[model samples]
Target: MRVLVQRVRSASVTVDGEVVGEIRPATQGLLALVGVTHEDDATKARRMAEKLWQLRILDDERSASDVSAPILVVSQFTLYANTDKGRRPSWNAAAPGPVAEPLVTEFTDALTALGATVQTGVFGADMQVHLVNDGPVTVLLEL
Candidate 1:
């Protein structure tokens, strides 16, 4: 599993012009673009969730674990896109929808189980994500 974690002041997801999920931080929050590969399982999903919670990116020397900041998760298989060889990116590293959807759900559920206030984008849907990226702080997480 891989995630692009971005600190955000606020974030939202829209599908077909309807807002699906939205979050505004009291302080700071995270917008997670999550990806699932063929090898990713519940264990990897769980570990990544835990790591995101503990990551010390927030101010006041606090972690999301410390403040219980909200998280907005979006399924983003495109994270695995490989473009080294050609103009058309190869998606071979990404798991197809049937294989990936459940893992994405599991990842979000695991984060919720860990007490995160988790919001999500619709899996397999065309989504528009909007965010005010705090600090422009972005990090790639993998497990």
Candidate 2:
């Protein structure tokens, strides 16, 4: 599992002109782009969720757990793209949809269980996402 976590002032996702999920935080929060690989499982998802909740990248070095911040979770298999051999990128490292979708859901569910307000983009959808990045802070975690 790999996750790209961005601190954001607000974020939202829309599909076919309809808002699917959004997070309008009164304070700084996070936008989590989740990715799953063949080796990833529920345990990795849970661990990633815990790390995202406690990551201290927000203002004043406060964590999302510390400030009750929200998180917008979006599926992004592209995080595993391989561009080493040719001009075209290879997606062989990314897990297939059927294998990945459930793990992504587990990650979100774990975050919610940890008392974090979680928003999500529809899996496998062509989504349009908008976000106001706070401090332009971003972190990538791989497990």
Candidate 3:
């Protein structure tokens, strides 16, 4: 499992012109782009959530856990794009929807269990994500 974490002041995910989830935080929050691959399981998903919540990339080096930040989660299988060969990227490394969707849920569930307010995008849907980045901070966590 991989999570691309970005610190943001506010973020939202829209699907089919309808806003599905959003968070406009007073302080910095996170937009978590999650990807699942073969061999990834619930444990890895949970671990990834823990790491994301504890990551110290927010203002003054404070973690999301320290400030009770909100999180906007989005499924992003393209994170596994393999471009080692030709121009067209290969999705072979990404887990199929059937195998990935539940794990992504596990990740979100884990984050909620950790006491963070969370929002999410529709899985497998064409989404438009909007955000105002904070400090332009971005981090990737793979487990």
Across 32-111, the per-residue lDDT of candidate 1 in tens digits comes to 99999999888888889999999988887677889999999999999999999969999999999998898888888889
List candidate 2 segments past 4 Å from native.
none
The candidate that achieves the highest TM-score relative to the unseen native structure: 3
**Each prediction's Cα lDDT score?**
0.93, 0.94, 0.95
Better of 1 and 3 by TM-score: 3
Per-residue lDDT for 1-143 in model 3, tens only?
Answer: 88899999999999999999999999889999999999999999999989998999998889999999999999999999999998999999999999999999999999999999999999999999999988888888888
TM-score winner between candidates 2 and 3: 3
| TM-scores of the candidates in the order shown | 0.97, 0.98, 0.98
lDDT at position 51, candidate 3: 94
Candidate 3: which pairs clash? none
Each model's number of backbone clashes? Answer: 0, 0, 0
Q: In candidate 2, which residue pairs clash? A: none
For candidate 2, what is the TM-score? 0.98
Q: Candidate 2 overall Cα lDDT vs. reference?
A: 0.94
User: Which ten contiguous residues of candidate 3 have the minimum total lDDT?
Assistant: 134-143
